[model samples]
Target: MPPKRAFDAELQALEALRQATPEEALPHLTKTLTHRNNFLVSKAATLAQHHNLTALAPNLAEAFPRFLADAPKSDPQCWAKNAIAKALAHFEYQDPDLYLIGMRHLQPEPVWGGNEDTAGPLRSTCALALVQCRTINSHKLLLHLIPLLADKELNVRVNAARAIEQTGTDSSALLLRLRAELASDSPELLGACYAGVLSLEGPSAIPWAARFLPPEDDAAAEAAMAIAQTHTPEAVDILKSTHKRARDPWFRKATLSALALTRQQSATDYLLHLIEQDTQTADAREALMLSAPSPETLSRLQQLAPNPNN
Candidate 1:
């Protein structure tokens, strides 16, 4: 009956359920979903999701609000709520209200000096899930999601951008562009926005992203990386031009790294040229290796700059 022993027994029981037939596991999983322990409830919800137990979604739903009622104590880290929401999302639960509730929920538990909101992950998960809800049109969803782009949590903002990207609307692309322009700090967030715009608008948007390549800030690096992800000849050209124009060594290195990520033959050839010409040789070599270049490229690199150790 001790807490630790009870926890161990519960874990063993959950593990055992993994081996049972779906029918046999259902009742046990259902019962465990109601357990007071947040950890156990989280594990049970994960099992439910893993096994594709759509049948227990209602139970998972019930447990979600129960934990939310006294979130700080009942779900210190929003563990139970997070798991349940993820499971529900996996099931493609169509109800927008539940996701809406979770997207707005904020549970700030006590930290060392003050209270830190533990519900950011929960909000992020719900935001992503909300995108899949067919009932809510893109406009309404964006209305709800737009505010989260400025969320206090960096991860939440990043995921919020991703969720908007999932909307795949022209409006969504514009929203990302606006965010990318307005966000002065948080390169990661800018990266997400850049990626979203690239994804939504395709190759034509490369120029728009390239504009950010100036100023040689972290935002520029993010823009370079995002453009490189396109893996198009245009991307290679854009990166190459940017690399040539960059006076900042850091920006040049970052552009080379992005060029390597493109995996295009032209990008590879350009990097090899840099190494052979002894222009940013170390960085070019590092970029080539990091890109996992083709065997021919690798052989050429070795020839151009033979390894002393090899």
Candidate 2:
């Protein structure tokens, strides 16, 4: 029972964490997990997991049961189960009971609240939780997730596809079929489904993801990102070429950013080369700033700077 009006202050603190580095925010987030309020604890768990604070795993694991026990009999606005499941998933918790309960509780359509979107977060997160189940066999998790592909909520269906992807299931055929369905029904889901295929098939997904790139459609930026995320040698070459050839500055910048996300030596070298050239330095520098700057980049920036003695 945190003091009344704590939720507002808690929310503000959470927002501040977005700007704060993980190192700076971990202490506050850890303290928040010990708070009595369910919503605050759930939020802290989510923040910790998002920051990849593995040190907080034991705390999150202990907190999950308490959060579950405190869950409202009816669906509440500050639902904790979804957040808890998200945190636990990051820690690779292997509790089958949690997964089973999540699967069982999922409704194809919203059963609570006046709006139909209310249940999407919970059901979708449950699908995500299945993907993170470490102790269970992948096949078993697959069995639980496959049915969710047909869920009415886009979030649930997309997450289910992602879960299947995480299970290393050969879901190319299913993914293609779902892509076609999403093409007609829900365009937003198509990107995630394609990403799932990439995760499952790796280079095999290049052809499909590439179709979304320039001259064929308006999804070139997105395709560039998806391809870059693969972090394969082929992806690196493709991204470099895409950045060079793209006429759209936004598209070129997107490709550069994607390349930076890979954080590979070759990618960093390419960016460094771009920054030395007059034609592309501005955009390359911007993207490099957005990336996790490497030691080489720091050294280069220093060399490029004017000496105070001069």
Candidate 3:
């Protein structure tokens, strides 16, 4: 089929799937499940999701291993891994605890989104998948991922950090180790260190991050945003005293965002003042929104603005 024609057909089928009554949809969905076409099988899965077709989720699992074991080697393995993640992500939402059993079936698989050569993609994506299973039961995944802290791959370390954040678990030692690595001169290692610490103790990082922040003109702004999570009373004391503070708006913006995360209610007035000073910038607008006063606090922001015309 011509590309557009095939797409049009798929869209029509999807619309029909969406419109079908649950009773009517189940049998057609069952027929589609037998389809060898990858396109149809996944579309059926999506329809199953839209209709809350809980019964079909397990049936869909019948084809999942093929979707994994059959991945052609020449193509990037990440695509297959990501498909597995998407499938598992949707299914686990139906029964959160099923993830423990499901993950055991999926482990040691290839990484979905990380660099392919190293184990980064597999480890990182696995960690993320486990994290998504949080709604099902995070403790199981948390127990499984803890040992990964000793994983030699820096990318794995970064992702494991994300997993910990999603689970809201503690990893003070790993975070401190990452914080210590922030002193390294190597940018990649330093980037990994910063990425790892952003979730658990963003404020605790101020002391270490202040020393290693790249020059404003360098392309390390994203890393700076990640690293800035460590800014806090324990960390930002360093930011407050940094010697060559960069002229970059983003770097400054990251620092301010971190500061806002501290919830220093006393600093609310200062934060509100800064947001007003840069009404046109999205970062400022976001920081203002984040700092919204609680029931105990009054509305400090007076400027009601629309989203920028991005």
Which candidate ranks first by TM-score, i.e. highest?
Answer: 1
Give model 1's TM-score versus the native structure: 0.95
Worst 10 residues of 3 by lDDT: 98-107
- What are the per-residue Cα lDDT tens digits for candidate 1 across 1-310? 9989989998999999888888888998999998999999999999999889999989998888899787899899999999999999999998898999999999999999999999999999999999999999999999999989879999999999999999999999999999988966499999999999999888999999999998899989999999999999999999999999999999999999999999899999999899878999889988988988888988999999876567
The TM-scores, one per candidate, come to 0.95, 0.61, 0.54
Candidates ranked by TM-score: 1, 2, 3
Candidate with best lDDT: 1
Q: Would you list the C-alpha lDDT of every candidate in the order shown?
A: 0.93, 0.69, 0.53
Candidate 2 vs. true structure, TM-score: 0.61
Task: Report the error of model 3 at residue 294, Å.
Answer: 11
Kindly list the per-residue Cα lDDT of model 2 for residues 85-136, writing each as its tens digit.
Answer: 6777777777767756765453222356644444467777767776666677
Candidate 3 residue lDDT tens string, 1-310: 9977976786587669788887788988777766555566667767776777777766665655555443443223334334434554655544443333333332333557643343355556566666765354555666776666556666665566556656654554365345445444334544555555555545554445544565642225435445435434543344433312546676666555654554555334445555556632466457646755564333445443344552
| Model 3, global lDDT | 0.53
Q: Local error of candidate 1 at 167, Å?
A: 0.3
lDDT of 3 at 193: 52
Off by over 4 Å in 3: 1-11, 21-23, 73-84, 93-126, 131-160, 167-176, 179-198, 201-250, 253-268, 271-310
The segments of candidate 1 whose C-alpha lies over 4 angstroms from its true place after superposition are: 19-24, 307-309
